[model samples]
Target: MISQLFSGIAVLSLIVLLLILLLRRLKQPYFIAYIAAGILLGPHAFNIIHEPDVIKQAGEIGIIILMFSIGSEIDLEYLTRNFYKPLLITFVQILMSFICMYSIGAYLDWKITIILLTTFIISLSSSAIVFQYLARTGEIKSQLGMITCGVLLMQDILVIPMMLTLNFMSGNTVSMQQLIKVCAGGLLMILFLRGAITKRLFKIPMQKELTADHELQIFIGFSICFTMAWISGWFGLSTAFGAFAAGILIGHDKATHWLGESLIPFRVFFMSFFFLAVGLQLNINFFIENAATIILISFTVIFINSLINTILFKLAENSWRDSLYGGALLSQIGEFSFILMTMAAALKLVENYTYQITLAVITLTMLLTTIWLMIIQRLIYRLS
Candidate 1:
């Protein structure tokens, strides 16, 4: 495993470097080339490695680090007002996603349980990927960009209970009483984490202390995230949701910048492993038999997702740019899908082979985001 680990690192680094050099001439998004390179080198190209479980473990830690960074970056006023539009978009998107995905599931004669879970899971879009790209490109300050970022934030908040509910409902050994117990237990933790107990920590003015104790703030912030994540997973909830909850609480605290900065070197190091691990999941045979299906589904999902986002933005009293914001950013699949797939596999809903197909397609889409956005913007500009 250690040998494979170093090998994976070497492979990813080489691929990333090549993408960097090529994109300069290709004049496209670097990530598109990243995924393309990953696909080529994956089981498809050289067959350098297998065993996705190793990389997935790396991703789990990446989630923890990602959450810590978010907590560190949290500005109190920005977050307080961040919930509304994104919340509205989440509500609107979820409803639409449910209707669309469930209908397809039913028409395909899928089981009710399968349809419900898949629809719910598939409707989700990744906020971490979306927000990072927007911020990196300096678009987060724009109106559409803010809305896009907010929508991503809102989705992060929303996916918590959504995942918890899905996990409990799908458990094969679960009974009615057990399901209720899971819900009650999960709710208790969420309330405790977000409630008065959690708020008191935030109330402490840590600005002065933070200047002197930035490392302490990072420690406390990361501790809270990991602790909350452990509890959520224990209660059959999504740990990622717990991580986000931790951020909301710590963001309210005074040492936000100190905490974020302290964790940066750590987060960046771990997240690269996470991305590489995901790249390792794209095996050759999985893509060979399922390439057509994966491509078709990915295109369909991204296309409709963009349209829905546009319409939602218009309804939000925003412009068609909303659609561009929503659609372009979401063209890729998120890290959350892996969690959903794991749970689904446990419940016998998704085949063992199935998760890789989705992962490959989504990863491809995510990498294409840079290219897709540039081209689509031009197309839209011309159409207008």
Candidate 2:
């Protein structure tokens, strides 16, 4: 079993390496390479990986850690000062998405539950992909980047209510206890953020001892991340949000700067797993069969989402060029949408065909985001 595990890792690494090289030559994001690698090794292709569920579960850890890293690096002060902008943007974006999806569903004679599910799914933009792009370009701390990050964070927080709504729609009784826990969790998080911002700086325990021990640093960092994730999950919230909260606390501490630095390798490695799982789930045959419809839906989603965000950013006083680019940055549907999709499926809110199509559409949007951003950038350049 160990030998087979080693062999699988070797093959996966080789394929990913080759794909990354090719994508590099084409000036594409590394995520594309990771997803391509998954498709190549997935059941639809070589069928080399037999345990996709295991891979996918592991990939979720990557998301949690990635959120932690983003949280830690975030300029909390800037986010706090401009909090209303993101709040407004996310609220309007969600409202627009609901209205748009409701209109489509009505025209198609679809159910309200389906419309709500679809609305929440498309309303979110992929934090992982957008952050990766910003980090790669060294714009993560820039004004636009901060604004984008704030919007994404707001979207993440809103997932809790989305989940509750879905459960209620599906005839599942959400206990009052759960609601109270969620409210309490949210209050605590708000207070924590407030304190962190007010304090501006703090120190982690055993700072000096942790400085010299690279091995301990990794374990300590992961502990902080996952412990917070556990707490948030217990409170009926997004685990990634919990991890992000932990990161914010750590970020404010000068002594814990090394924590973020120490986890960089782990973040990159696990994040690849997340994208790989996305690729593994892509049904090539299904996509080929419904090529026209899927392609149309994918393009439509990107277009509508970009338009809504662009309008909102412009209203928030951003220049047209930056607003357009910001909209493009958030054009793709987010990873959390997949969780919603899965839940909707389990609750029988959507048909299997609908589930598969949504999955394919989300994957396609993510895959196309880089290309979409490039086109937007060029257009802005010419117009400027």
Candidate 3:
């Protein structure tokens, strides 16, 4: 087993490296190469890597780190100063999506639980993917980028309630009272961390020591991220949420600069595997069999999200260009949607075939986000 694992790792590494080179040359998203590598190594192809459990565990850690990094970059002060616009837009988008999906679900005879889950899933966007694209295109500090970040941040916070609601609706023991308590605790922690702990954190002689031994600084950074992640799990929240909170607590600190630099290589390595794990789940046969249905559903979801969000942004007084770009950036389903769908499937709320089809549709929508955004931008420029 050890030999097999090592051999599989080696082959996968080589595939990622070569594809990275090709993707770089083509000026395409490098993450897609990681997914392609996973597909090649997956059961659908050569079946080189058999221990999916190991990859999944590693990928989970990768997600934690990714969220941590994203959290670190978010300046709470800046977000607060201009929160209302994005918040209102996000709320409007959610209300509109919920009504539309509920009506569709009723017509299609879907259960209330499924309808609610599907509504929230399509209503939120991928913060990771959207922010990454924005950063790559030098728009991370732009108006649309900030708006997108704010909306995604709100969506991340709402994930807690969404999960608890799912538990309640699925006949789990979770109650509204318990849900409110959990939310209150989470909010209190956020305030405490941002107010007290963050001030104390910067007072530590972190910068002096970090400047001397870089490896120690990296260890300390990981320690902070992991500790927060552990605390979040103890509070019945996702570890990624905890890591992100930790990042926000340390946002723009002198230590964060070095920590970000030190963590890049690890993030790259782990996140590549994370994307690969997503690819491994892509059953080509299933996707091909349901290609038309998957594409149609995916397209409809993206279209509605983009249209609604764009209109909301415009109503919020954003320029047409920025609003359009923001809409395109957030048109796809988020990573948390996969978690919700998986949980729903486990609880037998969603049928097996429907679950598979949904996964395929979500994956396809995510895969197309970059190209779709590119096309949207081109059309925007042409029309303008």
Local accuracy of candidate 3 as per-residue lDDT tens digits, 1-384: 568868987898889999989988978888788778877898988999887667867877887888888777776666777899878887888899989988998899988888888987898787668867876787766766777888887887787778877887888888567767677768866776766444664443657767778888788879989998988877777788788887777665655576777787888778777778777877778888889899999999888988998898888788888878888888998777877888888888888897888778777778888888888899899989
Best by lDDT: 2
The RMSD of every model to the true structure, in order and in angstroms, is 4.0, 1.5, 2.1
- The residue pairs that clash in candidate 1, if any, are 32-367, 310-323
lDDT of 2: 0.91
lDDT of each: 0.66, 0.91, 0.80
Tens-digit lDDT track of model 2 for 1-384: 568678889999999999999998999989998888888889998888888888888889999999999888888888888989999999999999999999999999989998889999999999999988898898888888999999999999999999999999999999999999999998987787677557654456788999999999999899889998999899888999999998988887767888888999999899999999998988888888998999999999999999999999999999999899999999999999988998888998888889889999999999999899989999999999
lDDT: which is higher, 1 or 3? 3
Q: Could you arrange the candidates by TM-score from highest to lowest?
A: 2, 3, 1
Q: Residue 142 error for model 2, in Å? A: 1.4
Return the clash pairs for model 2, or none.
none
Candidate 2 runs further than 4 Å off = 196-202
Number of backbone collisions per candidate, in order?
2, 0, 0
Model 3 gets an lDDT of 0.80
